[model samples]
Target chain A: MYELTKVIKDYHRGREVVHALAGVDLDITDGEWLAIQGPTGHGKSTLLQMLGGLDRPTSGSVVLEGKDLAGLRESEITAIRANAIGFIFQTFNLIPTLSAQENVEAALVPLGVSTADRRAMAASALEGVGLGDRLRHLPSQLSGGQQQRVAIARALVKEPMVLLADEPTGNLDEETRDDLMALLEDLWRELRLTMVIVTHDSAVARRAQRIAVMRAGKLAIKQDTRPAPAA
Target chain B: MFATYLRRELRRRSRQVVLIALGLALGVGLVITVTAASTGVKNAQAAVLHSLYGVGTDITVTQAPAAGTGGPGGFGFGLNRGTRTRPAPGTKFTSDRLNPGQLAPLADSAVTKIARLNGVAAATGSLTLTDVSISGTIPSFGGSAGASGGSASGGTPGSGGRGFITPNVFGVAGVNLTQGAIGPLSSGKITAGRTFTSADASANVAVVDANYAAQHKLKVGSTVAIGGSTGKSTSFTVIGLVSTASGSGSDVYIPLLRAQQLSGLTGKVNTIYVAAASATEIGGVSKQISTVLPKATVTTASSLAGQVTGSLASAASLANSLGRWLAIAVLVAAFALAVLLTISAVSRRVREFGTLKALGWRSRRVVGQVMGESLLVGLIGGIVGIGLGLVGASLVNAFTQPLTAAVGPTTGSATPGGSRVFGGAGQFGGSPGAGPGSAFRRLASSQTVTVHLTADVTATVIIAAVLLAILGGLIAGGFGSWRAARLRPAAALAKIA
Candidate 1:
C-alpha cells in the first residue's frame, strides 16, 4: 500500500523554481495495477519516483506499507527499495557490460544473496520471461523487446511487493511494445504485485485496474476499471 | 559482489590500466636506478677513504710545510718535511747536508702528551725521507750511481713525466703503526720476504719499495749502499720489498732510530697517525691535535671522503643531481597521467555506478569499488616497476664502471706515545746528477690509485619503491573515489532515460 499527502516537488532550473508535483494527494492499494498517465512535464515520472522511494518529495510524506519514507534513513529507504519494491525504466536500463542473467542477478546483490541462489533465481526469472537461452547475451545484443523482458526479469527476481515502471513501452516498436506489455501483464497477474506504471499510451492505461490522469502537476482524475473485492 | 564488480570493471578496462601501470613502472624504475648508483658511490668512497690512512686508522696529523719553502714536487704531490731546510733558499750546502733543527716541532714528548689527551685511543709516528742517495747503479736510470739526480726529467717509466722519485734516494723509517701493527702495506703490498722488526733497529736492514728494487735489480738479503744528506753512507741488507706504486713511491724503509741517526734530525717526527677511542671521537681528537700543535693539519676520514675524485667526480655528481630531477619529473608526469586516466574512466562510468547505488550500494561501497580497481592496477604496476628497476640497474651497472679514485697519501709527524721520534732528512746539496737548472732538492711524488665501486640495490630502496608505487595508485584512486562518491543516483540514473 502507498499514500502521498500534499506532496510538492520543486526543481531549480538556473534561477526559477519549477513545481513538478504541487500539492499532490493520492493512495495506492496493495496488489492493484495502477497507471499514472500524462503528457511530458506533468509529474507522471515524479510521482512514480516518490512511490518507489527513488526520490524524496520536497515537502510532505510518501508512505509505503504504512511506513513514511520521509521519516526513514537513507539506508533504510534503500533497504525498502531493494527488498520491497523493484523499478523498471522506459529504456530498459541494464548495465551494458553485464549479460542478461548478470543484470537480473544484480538486483539481489545488495540483499547479500548467496551466489548459487542468485544464479538459480536469476536463471529461473529469465526462463519465466522466455529468455533462458539468451542468458549470456549482453543488452546491446538483445532486441528492444528482449531487453525489456530482461528488465522485467530483473525487476521480478527480487519478488518485491510493488513494481514501478516509467514509460515501459515508450521506446519500442508497436509490435514489441505489445509483446512487452503482455509480458508485464502476465508477470503482474502471476505474482499479484502492486504495479504502478507511468505512461501516455491509452492501450497501457486500459489494462490497469485504476487509471489516474495527471495534469498541471496534479492528479486531475482517477478512473476505476475493475471492481474492488471484499476490502 | 564488490570483488566481482571490481574484476569485471578491470577486465573491461584492461587497456587503460596497463597504460597507467606502465607509466608508474617507468617512474619507479628510474628512481631505483638513480638511488642505487648514488649508494654505490657512497660505498666506494667509504672503502677508499678507510684505506687512505691505513687499516683502522681514523685520523692523520701532518705539519704543513710553509708554502714557497718547498715546491709541490714531482708527481703533482704536496711537499712534506722530506728534506732538512737550508739556511737560505737556493743556497746549496757545499757539504752534503746541514744539521736538522726548528721545523719539525713534533717530538717524542709531544706524542706522549697527545696520547694522554681525551679520545686519543692510540697514537704513532712515521718518518718520510727524500733526496737520500743509493750507491748501486739502478739499471733503469742508465745504471749510473748518480742517475737519480740526472735531468729530474724522467721519474718511473710510464709516469707521464710526473711522480718522479726525487734525485735524492728516498727512505722511510719506523713501521707506520698509525695503521696499527697490521701495517700500511697490508695484504700483498709487501710482495716478498718479511717486514723490518725491532731487532733490526741497530742492524743495517731495509725494506725497499718494489719499483725501486726492480729498477736497481735489488733482491731480498742483498746488501746495498745507502747515503743520507749527512754525507754518511751505510751498507744495509734488503730484508723485504713492498709496492708503493699506488702511493707516493718512497723507496726504502728502516728502523726509526736508524733513520733518525742517518738524517741527523733527532728527536723529531714528520707525521703522526692518531686513532680515536671511538669513531665518534675523531672530531674531538682532531681538535685536540690542533690544540697541541697549532701548525699541524689534521685530516679525518669523513673530511677526506668529501673530496671528489677526477672528472669522474663530476660525472657522478651530475648523475646524482640530474638523475634525481629526472626521476621526480617522470614521477610527476606519471602521476598526472594516471590520475587523468582514472578520472576519465570513472567519469565514463557515472551511470553504471549510479545504477548500483540505486540498487542499494552505499556511497562508501561505490568508493571502495573505485579504489579496489585502482589498487589492483597499482599492485600490477609495482610488480612491473620492480622488474623494470632491476633491469635498469643492471643495465647501468653494465655500462658504468664502478671505480673511485683512491685518496692520495698524506704526510705529517705521527708519534704514538713512545720514545721513538721517527725522523729522516734528504740532500740539500747539489750534485752533478742533480741536472742543470733543476733544484737539487728532492720532490714529492704522486700516483693515482683506483678503488672499485659496486652498485648494489639495497632492501630499503626496494621497499621504498614498492611503497611509492602503492602511494601513486592510492593518490590516483583518491581522485576517482571523490568523483564517484559525489555522484547522485537519482540524477545519474535519470541521465539514462
Candidate 2:
C-alpha cells in the first residue's frame, strides 16, 4: 500500500535549485493494479523513489502503514526495504558479478537468510519465472526478455508487500512486451500480488485495474475501465 | 569484520600492498643494519680504551711544568694531549675526555688523608710525558695488544714500515706491591732474584718491559745504559723483568731519592697513581682527593666510560632520529600510493558495492573485509626487512672489523702499549694507519660480529618495524570504500558514467 500527502522534492547545486517534484498527492490500495502514466521528467521516477525510501522528500510526508517515512532512521528504512519492498528497473538491474540464481539470492542477503536456504529459495523463484535451467547464466548472457524474467523472479522471491516496477518491459520488443504482459497478469492472478507498474503503453495500461495519469508533478483523476458488469 | 575488510582490500589491491610492504621493509632493514654496525664499533673502541687506561683508569694525575703554559687544564694545549675521555663540566656532551688540571689540587697535602679512607684501593703513582723513553735493566715487557700491527687486515707490514723508537730515559718512584708477583725483570713488577729492598734503596738496579727488553735485546742480569732529560747517563744491572705488556712495564725501579738523583731533580716525582678499592668508592674518593689538591682534578673510571659511551650515544641518537623520520616519510609515501591505487580499483566496483549495501551489509563489515588483506601484505614486508637487516649486519661485520673503536670526549693522546688492559685485541682503527676510506670499505665487507642481542633488544626492533608496515597498508583500503557507501541509488545510477 502507498500513500502520500502533498509530497514535494527538489535538488540544489551552488546557487541554483531544480524543483523535481512541486506537489504530488496520490494513494494506492492493496492488490491494486495501478498505472501512473506520465511523460519523461514529470516526476514519475522521483515519486517512485520517494515511495521506495531511496530518496528523501524536501516537504510533506510519504506514509506507508500509518508511519511517515521521514520519521524512520536510515537503518530502519533499510530494514523495511529489505523485508517489504521489491523493485524492477528499466534496465533489468541484475548484478553482473552474480549468476541468475545469485541475482535473486542477492535480495535475500538482507533478510538474514542462511546462504544454503537463500540459494534454494532463489532457485525456486527462478523456476516460478520458467527459467529454472538458466540459473547459472549471467545477466549479459541472458536475452532482454529473459533478463527481465530473471528480474521478475528476484522481485517475487522476497514475497514483498508491494512490487514497484519502474519500467519492467521498457526495453523489450513488441512481442516480448506482449508476452511479459501476459506473464505479469498470470502472476498477478496467481499470487494476488499488489503491484504498481508505471508505463506509457496503452496495451499495458489496459491490463491494469485502474490508470492514474500524472501531469506536471500532480496526480490527475484515476480511470477505472474494468467491466462494470460485476457491479 | 575489520580484518575481513582489510583482507578484501589487500586481495583487491595486491600490487599496491606488495609495493608498500617492500618500501617499509627496505627502510626498516637499513636502520637495523646501520644501528648494529655502529654499536659494534663503539664496543671495540671501549675495549681498546680499557687496555690503555686499565679497568678504572679514568683520570691521570700529571704535575704542572715547573714553568711555562700548557693549557687551561694544566695538562696540555692539544685536544689530543689531555685526559678527556669524559666531558668536563663545560662539555656539551659526555665522551672519553681528560678534564684539564684546572679541577685538580696540585698540592700534595690535599690528597694524603684520602688514601687512608675506607674503600680506598691502592693509590699508585705514575708519570707521563709528551716525549720520553726508558733503558735500564729493562725487562722485555712487550705488550701484544699495543700497536702490534696484528689487528690489521692484510697481516703484512703497513706501508709505514718498522716504527722508530726514541731512547730518552727517566727514573721513577716505586709503589708497594699489591696485585701479583713479577714474572721477569721487566719495567713491570719483577718475578726474579729480587726487587730492591729498603735496605738497598740506593742500589743502582733497573727493570724494563719485555718488548723494551726485546727492542734493546737486554736479558736479566745484563746492564743497560740510560739517559735523562738533562743528558744524564747511567748504567744499571737488569736485576729483574716484569711480565706486563710493553707499555705497562717500566725501565727502572729505584727509591724516590735515587730517581731524584738520576733525573737531576732534588726529590720531585712527575706523576701519581691513584687507585681506589672498588669502582664504586672511586668516585667519592676521587672527589675527596681533589679537595686536598685544589690544583689537580680527580676523576673516576666511570666518568671516562660515560664520556666515551655518551659520544657514541649522541651519534646513535642523531642517526636514529634521521632514520625514524625517514621511515615515517617513506611509510607516508607508501600509504598514499596504496590508497590512490586501491580507490582506483574499487571505484570500478561501485555498483556492486551499492548492491551489497542495499542488501543490508553494514559499512563496517565491508571495511573489515577490505582491511584484512592489508595485514598480510604488511607481514611479508616486515619479514623481508628483517632478513635484509640480518644479511647487511653480518656481511658488513664479516668483511670489516667490529665498529666498536675508542670513542671519547677526551682528546688526550693514548699510548699503544696501554691498550693491553682490555686483555683482548686492542682498539681497532685508532692508529694513523686506517683512513676513512679503509674503514668504510671494511664496513661494506664482512663486518661479522658476536652481538648478544637480548630478547628486549630484539623485541624493540621488531615492534618498531612491523607496526609501521601494518599501519601503512590498512590506511589505503579504508579511504576508498567509505566514499562508495554515501551514493544514492538514483544519483549513483546517474553518476555511473
Candidate 3:
C-alpha cells in the first residue's frame, strides 16, 4: 500500500523553479485498482513516480508500507524499485538489442539469477501475457500493443507488490486498446496485483476500483467506486 | 576469461594482428641479422689472429723511430719498427737489437710462462750466426712471389725493376716447429705433415709459412742453404709449413734459441707469450706481466680480440644510432595505436557515456572502464609485437654471417682461449671481453659484448621488447584516463546518433 500525503515536486531550470506536484495527498489500500486522471502538467505522472519511489518529492511524505520513500538514499530507492516496484511506461522502454525474452533476462542478470530460473520465470511471465510464442521476437518486430504486452510481462516477471503504469493505452489503436484493457482486467482479477494507472481516458478511469482526479499540481478529489456508483 | 577474450579479439582482428606481426617481424629480423653479421666478423678476427699470433705474447717490443720521424700515413702503426733506424734503407746490418735476456727477470715473477713471439711454423737459431745472407734467387725467371709487396708495374718480374728473395728478419719459433711441438691452432687445425719434434732442434731443420713455401716453389724435405757473415750457415731441411694464407711473403722461421743465435739478436728477444689462467684472468695476467716486465707494457688478450673484430667494432658503433631510430619508430607506432584506440572509444561511447551518467553511474566507474579498454588494446599489441620480433630474429639469424673483423688474428692469449677469426659462430665470450686491437680496446672494460642472437642475445632483445610494450600500455591507459576525465557527464550522455 502507498500513501501520498501533501507532496510537492519542484523542478529548477536556470532561474525558474516550477512546481510540478503541489500538495497532493492520497491513500489506497493494497490490491486495489486505482486510476489517476489529469491533463498534462497536472502532476499525475509526478505523483505516480513519487508513489513508486523512483523520484523524490520536494517536500512532504510518500509512504509505502510504512517506509518513507522520500527519505531513502538513491541506491536504497533503486533496490526498493528492483525488489517491489514495477513500472510500465507509455512508450514500452525495452532494450532494442535484446529479444523480448532476453530483455527480461537482462534485468535478472544484474540480479544474479541463474539462467535456467530466469528463462523459466520469463517464459511464464510471457505466457501470462499471452506472448509465449513471441518470446524470441525483438521489440522492433512487435507492434505497439505487443511491445506494451512485453513490457507488462517484464513488469510481472519479478512479481512485485504493485505495478505502476503511465498512459498504458496512450499509443494503441482502439481495438488493441480494448483487448489490452480486457487482459488487464482479467489479470487484475486472477492475480490480484495492486496496480495504478495514470491516464486521461475516462473509459480506463471508469474500469478502476477507485478514481483520483488531479488539477493544478494537486489531487482535487478521490471517489470510491462501490459507494460512488450508488451516488 | 582473459585468454578467451584475447582469442576472440585476435580472431575478430586477425587481419590487423597479422599486419602488426609482419611489421614487427621485419624489424626484429633485421636486428638479428645485422647483429649476427657483426658477431661473425668478431669470431673470424679472433680465430685468425690467435693462430697467427700467440694470445699472451706481451709488449711487441718493436724499435720505435726517434720522435717526429713520421712520414705520410703515419705508417699506420704509429712508427716503423720494421725499417732500419741506425743505417741506410735496406742496409745489411741495421735491424732492431734488444736484450732477449730481459725475459729472464720475467721468469722469476708471476710471469711463470714465456714464449718468444715469431710468425712461422718453425725457427732455428743455429749456433749464434752473426749474419745470414740466406737469400732466394729471382730465378732469372718470371714467377711472382706471393705478391705481398709487389707493385702494380709487376716490378719487371724479378728484373731490376726488382729481383730479390722475399726478405726475412727472423725470430725463434723454429725451435717449436723443428721439435714438432706447435701449440694449438684454433684447436687442432693441421693441414700438413707432422710438426717438428724436440730432436729436430738438433736435426738442423727449418719450417716456414705456407705462403713462403708456395712463393719459392719449395716443398717438404727441400734443403735450403744460405751464406752468413759468421760463415756459410747450416743448410736446413724444411720440415713443416704453417697453414695460414693470411699475410704474404717468404720468411723462414727457426727455433727460439736458433733464431736468437742467427739474428745475433740473442739475449735480445724481448717478447714472450704467456697464457692467462683463463679469460677472466686476462687482466690479472696483464698485470702480472707488467710487474714481471716492468719496462714493457703488457697487452691482454682482450686488447688483441678488439684488434681482431674490425667489422664488429663498426657495427657496434652503430648501436646508439640504430637504437635511437628503433626507439623513434616504436614510439611513433605506440602513439598512433593509442590515438586510434582512444578516438574510437570516445566516438563510440559519447551517447552511451551520457546515458550511464544520467543513470547514476559514477564518474570514476566510467573512467575505469575506458582505461580498461585501452589497457586491453595495449596488452594485445605488445604481445603481438614480441612474437613477431622473435620470428623475425630467427629469420635474420639464418642468413647472417656471424664474424667480426675485430675478432681475428689476436696477439695475446687468455686462458682456455683458442684463437681464430670470428668466423666460427661468433659469440662475445669470457671476461675482459677480448678487446679490439684498436680504439675499442679502451672500451672493453666498460663494454659488455652481447652474443650474436645466440641464447644470450635472444634474452636481451626479448627483455627490451617487453619493456617497450609496457611503456606503450602505460601511454594508452594514461591517455584514456586523461581523455575520459575531461568529458561533461550530462553532455556526454545526452548525444544521440
- Highest DockQ: which candidate? 1
| Model 2 residue B309 lDDT score | 42
lDDT of each: 0.69, 0.55, 0.51
Error of 1 at A179 (Å): 2.8
Models 1 onward score TM values of 0.77, 0.59, 0.51
Query: For model 1, what is the C-alpha lDDT against the true structure?
Result: 0.69
Interface DockQ of each model: 0.45, 0.25, 0.13
Per-residue accuracy of model 1 over A1-231 as CA lDDT, tens digit each = 988899999989999998989889988887899998987888888888788777888999999988999789888988888888888888788888788999999999889999999999999999999999999998999998899899889888999999989888988988988888898898899999999998989898889999998887899656897675778
Query: What ranking of all candidate models by DockQ puts the best one first?
Result: 1, 2, 3
Per-residue lDDT tens digits of candidate 3, residues B242-306?
66424411145455445545434343333334443345555654554455445554544556555
Q: Write the per-residue lDDT of candidate 2 for residues B296-370, one digit (tens) a residue.
A: 535444554444443334444544576447655665676677677667756766656654554445555455544
- For model 2, state the Cα shift of residue B273 in Å: 14
Runs in model 2 deviating more than 4 A are: A91-104, A130-156, A170-191, A198-208, A211-215, A221-231, B1-133, B136-325, B369-460, B495-497
Please name the candidate that would achieve the greatest lDDT relative to the true structure: 1
lDDT, candidate 1, B1-497, per-residue tens: 66776787788888999999999899988888888877877665555554444655677666634532232122211121234321222222221222221124357667677778899878766655543332221123332222233334332322321323333344454444333343334322678988866667677788887877888899999876655444546788998997742443346777666666666556666666677899889898889888988877677777665553643465468668998899999988988898899999999988788777766667787888888888888778877888888888788678876454633232222221111111222212122222221333233321234655556888898899888888888988999999999887777776533
Q: What TM-score, to 2 decimals, does candidate 2 have? A: 0.59
Label model 1 with its docking quality class.
acceptable
1 versus 2: better lDDT goes to: 1
